[model samples]
Structure formats: C-alpha cells, structure tokens
Target chain A: MLRFANPTLFLKLVRWLLPLAGGAGAVLLAWGLYLVFAVSPEDYQQGATVRIMYIHVPAAWLALSCYSLMALSSIGSLVWKHPLADVSAKALAPIGAAFTFLCLVTGALWGKPMWGTWWVWDARLTSVLVLFLVYCGIMALWTAFDDPARAARPVAILTLFGFINVPIVKFSVDWWNTLHQPASVFRMGGPSIDPSMLTPLFVMASGATALMLALHLAGMRTEIMRRRVRTLSQQLARQDGGS
Target chain B: MMDTPHAGYILASYLLAGVIVAGLVLLAVLDDRAQRKALARLEAQGLRRRSSGQTGEQ
Candidate 1:
C-alpha cells in the first residue's frame, strides 16, 4: 500500500483505474436500474412504491459506510500523517453528505406512504439524522480555520469521535424498539425478502457502491491537484517576492 | 399525473437522487480541470522568475 505513496506513482495508478471503475460503475448502474424498473417484484405489502428502496436503502448504507471510511482514513491522517488519507477524507465529505441527505429524504418518502407520516423520531431515524449532522459538522470544521492543518485536526478528531454512532445507527432497530424494520438481508439465516426482489436489490446496491467509489476517487484526484496548485502558487509568490 | 397510490413519492425521491449525484460529478470534474490549470500557470510563473533571478545575479 505504502509503495504507491509517491504522488506521481499514485496518479498513474489512478489514471489507469479511473476508466475501469467508471465504466464498470456505469454498466452496473444501467443494469441495476433496468432490473429495478422492469424485473424486480413489487412488495406484496407496499406495491409499486417499494421500488424506491432500490435507491434509498443503498444510499443510506453507503452514506454510513462512507462516514466510517472517512473516519478511518482521518485517523491515518492525524496519526501517521498519511498524505493520501487526509485527501481521501476531505474529498469524500460532500459526496457522503449528499448521500446522507438522499437517504433521509427518500426514507421520508417511503415512510409517509408506509407509515402514514413524513417524519418520525424512531431510534434508527434519529441516529441517522445525527449521522448527517456529524457530517455537516465535519465539513464546517474543514473551513472554519485559516490554517489548513488546524482546520483538518478538528475534523479528524470529530470523525473519530462520531464513528461510534455508526454502529448504533446500523443496529438501532434491533437494539431498541423502533419503527424501522429489523435486518432482513443481513441476518444469521438469510434474507427474508423473496429472491425475486433481492436480486435487483443486490445489483442496485453494488451499482450504487461502485458509483460512490467512482465519485470518491474522482473527487480525491481533484483534491490532490488542488493542493498541488495551492502549494505551487504559494511557492511562486514567495519566489517573486524574494527576487 | 402518475398518481398510483405512492407514485409521487417514489418519483420525487428518484429525481432528487439523480439531481444530487449528477451535480456532484460535474462539479468534481470541473474542480479537477481548474486545479490542473492553476498549477500549470503557477509552475510557469515560477520558472520565469527563477530564470530572471539568475540573470540579475550575473
């Protein structure tokens, strides 16, 4: 892993991997959407509206996963001073935030019909809401300081602190009596949902994850370039003043 | 118009997701290009200054 720490080496690897990741993501997304629209069975209880889960659940899971990833990477940045780690965390924030927002909105959409309300204070929902706020706080911290390192320090610490909430969000349904449904797909036995629905759900979940990775890597590349430009511009100004 | 029970909810949700994802991707690409250009320009300026500095010293 550290062998590719050199920026130029990393860039070359990213260049080769980008097209592959992006293309696979596109194909998976297309197939996933096709299955979602045409092949997957509607819920016996919820009817056509269950289709929203194709996008909603995946976004929710990805949002939480992305935050956990950012927190882990932030630890590396703060402790080991791994250059790419901080870049990865910084770049992933907006995309993760967007996913979290979608999860909340879509979950609300699903809830209004299924539960007869637009919003609820269920443990799962409330925890996810806190997760979103945590993301927002990290983003705000990133810009609150003029010194880049200082700005990053608080975010890193916050990320590490906030990760404790992820597990609570994940298991809130099981841990506490809640409106949210218990785990169906990830259980000791197997998915309780019919295979007809599970297939497309898996496809869409994979596609969404690939899409997340593609967006994240692309964003990370841009951040690397951005920092490079910032450093270079400062050097140029310094040289000009020196002479 | 597709008011089949909860169709409006599903449609709205999908639309929002699409808009957000597409907007983010476009912004990422734009930022990448902008940063690369800025770095190129700065490097060029630095090169010019270093060359001028050498001449002044001689």
Candidate 2:
C-alpha cells in the first residue's frame, strides 16, 4: 500500500483498474436494479417505498465508509507524510459528499410517506447530517489553502475530529430514542431481513462501491496531473526569471 | 409494480441517486481529461516536468 504512494506507480495502477471498476459497476447496477424493481417483493409495511432502500441503504453505508477512508488517509498524511495521502483525501471528498448528500435526500424522500414527514431531528438523521457537514467542511478546507501541502495537516486534524460522528451515525438509533429504524440487515445477531431482500442489497452495495472506485481513481489521476502542471508552471516561471 | 401508493417516492429516490452518481462520474472524467490536456499543452510549450527530465525546448 505504501509503495503505491509513488505517484507514477499509483497512476499506473489506476490506469488498469479504472476500466474494470467502471465496467463492473455498470453491470452490477443493472442486475441490482432489475432485482430491485422486478424481482424483490415490496415491504408489507412500507409498500413500494421500500424500493428506495435499494439506493438509500447502500448510499448511506458508502457515505460512512468513504469518510472512514478519508480519515484513514488523513492519518496517513499526518503520520507517514505519504505524498499521495493528501491527494487521496482530496479526491475522495466530493465523491463522499455526493454519496452523503444522496443518502440524505433519498432518506427524506423515503421518509415522507413512511414517517409522514420530509425531515426530522432524530439522532440517526441528525448525526448523518453532521457527517455531511463534515464532508463539506473538509472540502472547504481543501480549497481554502492556495497550497495543498499547507492544507494537509489542518484537514487531517479536522478529519480526525469529525470522525467522532461516524460511530454515532452507525449506532444512533440504538444510543437514542429515534424515529429511525435500528439495524436490521447488519445487526449483531445476523441480518433480520429476508434473504431475497438481502441479496439485492448486497448487490447494490457492490455497484455503489465499484462506481466510487472508478470515480476515485479518475479523480486521483486528475489530481496527479494537476500537481504536475503546477510544478511545471513553477519551474517555467523560475527559468524565465533566471533568464 | 408501479401501482403502489408510494411509487412516486421510490422513483424520486432512485432518480436522485442516479443523478448524483452520474454527476460525480462526469466531474471525475472531465477533470481527468482537462488536467491531462493541460499537462500535454505545458509539455508542448517547453515546460517539462522535473522528474520526466525530458526537456521540451532549447
């Protein structure tokens, strides 16, 4: 993992992996969607609205997972001072934010009928909102600095602090009396949901994961090129100044 | 399948997810293409990367 910190090597790996990720993501999503709309039975309670779970759960899970990844990258940046760590964090922010944002929106849409409200202040919902805000804060911090090198440590610290919310988001329904449902699919005892439903959920998750991988790889590649451009422009300026 | 009372909400959720995912993919692809183009342009203009060490201009 550390060896891939070499930007050139990272780029080479991304070059091969991006297409595979994208292709697999598309295929999984198609199969997942087919199962979601055509094969899976509706929730006895929620009716067709349960279909939203196909997207909402995976997006929510990925949102938390992405932040955890960013937090790990932050630790890498601060401790190892690995050159690619900050780039990984930066590349991940908007993608994670998008997933977080989607999760919120989809949840709200799903909630309107089931909960009879579009929004709520429940522990799970609120903490997830905070998680979204943290993503935004990290992204804002990234652009706040003219130099990414200077931004690394500050973002790293902020990410570490924001990470306090991840577990809260996970266990919120349990920790507090909330409208949100407790874990059914990933509980300690084992999944409470029917296997038919569980199958589509995992498949959708794979699709989301692959889609994220493709985007992250492309973003990382772009960031590397952006850095190279900055370096070359600086060197050109230096040459001109010397002449 | 589409007859459920909550079909609208389900559709909205799926549509929103599709849009967000598509938007992210577009941003990543565009950024990658733009940066690669910029790098190529810079190299064309005698701005070689230090590591590459292949001088583009005399």
TM-score of chain A of each: 0.96, 0.98
- The parts of candidate 2 lying over 4 Å away from their true place are B53-58
For candidate 1, the clash count comes to 0
What does candidate 1's lDDT look like per residue over A90-176, in tens digits?
878888899999999999999999999988899999998998998898888888876565667778888999999999998999999
Q: Model 1 chain A: which ten-residue window has the lowest total lDDT?
A: A3-12
Model 1: how far is A141 from its true place, Å? 0.9
A41-82: candidate 2 lDDT, tens digit per residue = 988887778889989999999999899999999999999999
Error of 2 at A196 (Å): 0.9
- Per-residue error for A225 in candidate 2, Å, reads 0.7
Task: Give lDDT tens digits, candidate 2, residues B1-58.
Answer: 8898778888888888888888888877788778777788878887767576443211
* DockQ, 0 to 1 scale, candidate 2: 0.59
Best by TM-score: 2
